[model samples]
Target: MAPVKKHGRRRASVSASELAQMGVCERLVVFEHRYGKRRTVEQQQAIKRGRRAHARFYREGHMDWTRWWRYFIVFLIFGRWLTLCVAKWFQVRKPHHET
Candidate 1:
């Protein structure tokens, strides 16, 4: 495709932030350009935002403990709640104890 036609090339402006994100994963830049998709719940999970935030509470400096707790609490409540709901649904639908 490249020899005959200049296709599949990104026209991204590739700003500093874009470059930084691309460093993590080029797909991020591509998705951002195509969908303008900002940070999502899944993305937060992938990056372990909750754990990262919670770490600050125990680290050397005791700054921003409130924010840390918020992150930890939200993920514990929402994330664990979602897991429990899915597990219950699967348990009801899944086959088991059959002859």
Candidate 2:
């Protein structure tokens, strides 16, 4: 493997994926580096589908805090008011003789 030139110096570093590919078939890795990767039509379509699916999943999982923070603040206020109401109810329900 040739060392990659960086900052006027040769650096020898193998990425995890490169090492994995080397483990599988070092000759294939060499050939791929020399020429290029050639994928079938189905493989290309599958890659596109996978990219779209990942993008969809990312969008679905993302939270827009600008739109959601107001609701969260409202929920907190309502919870505090409910708690106070419940505490007052318990105080009112207690017998006068218990004091």
Candidate 3:
């Protein structure tokens, strides 16, 4: 019979799913070692769907200050109005004494 070959130690590398599996069950690590881990078609589709949704939300919600100059003007107008209101309030609250 031919001499038996010896396998050397494998380089240690951990992936996100492997860490999650380790958290769930140690046996899952053995199962992954025995049979390679792969995502199911549904899982892949869900990931793609989530990525697309995030991209869509970001695109739709992103601020375009240049295009929204009116909002900036409105904010300045509101600030001026608030200052006027505070001044009027102080004028009305002026201390008065009666003999």
Model 2 TM-score on a 0 to 1 scale: 0.52
What TM-score would candidate 1 get against the native? 0.30
Pairs in steric clash, model 3: none
Candidate 3: residue 11 Cα off by (Å): 17
Estimate, for each residue in 56-91, the C-alpha lDDT of model 2 and write its tens digit: 877766656545887899999999999999999998
User: Please, what's the RMSD in Å of model 1?
Assistant: 20.4
Write one digit per residue (lDDT tens) for candidate 1, span 1-99. Answer: 011225756554544555576688876657666667667889769658656776865673555677788899999999999999999998889567775
For model 3, residues 45-90, the per-residue Cα lDDT tens digits are 9879988998988776665644478788988999999999999999
lDDT of model number 1: 0.68
Clashes of 1: 0
Where in model 1 is the C-alpha error above 4 Å? 1-63, 95-99
Q: Is candidate 2 or candidate 3 better by TM-score?
A: 2
Which segments of candidate 3 are over 4 A away from where they belong? 1-22, 26-37, 64-70, 73-99
**TM-score versus the correct structure, for each prediction:** 0.30, 0.52, 0.37
By TM-score, the candidates rank as 2, 3, 1
List the candidate 2 regions with Cα displacement exceeding 4 Å: 1-20, 63-75, 90-99
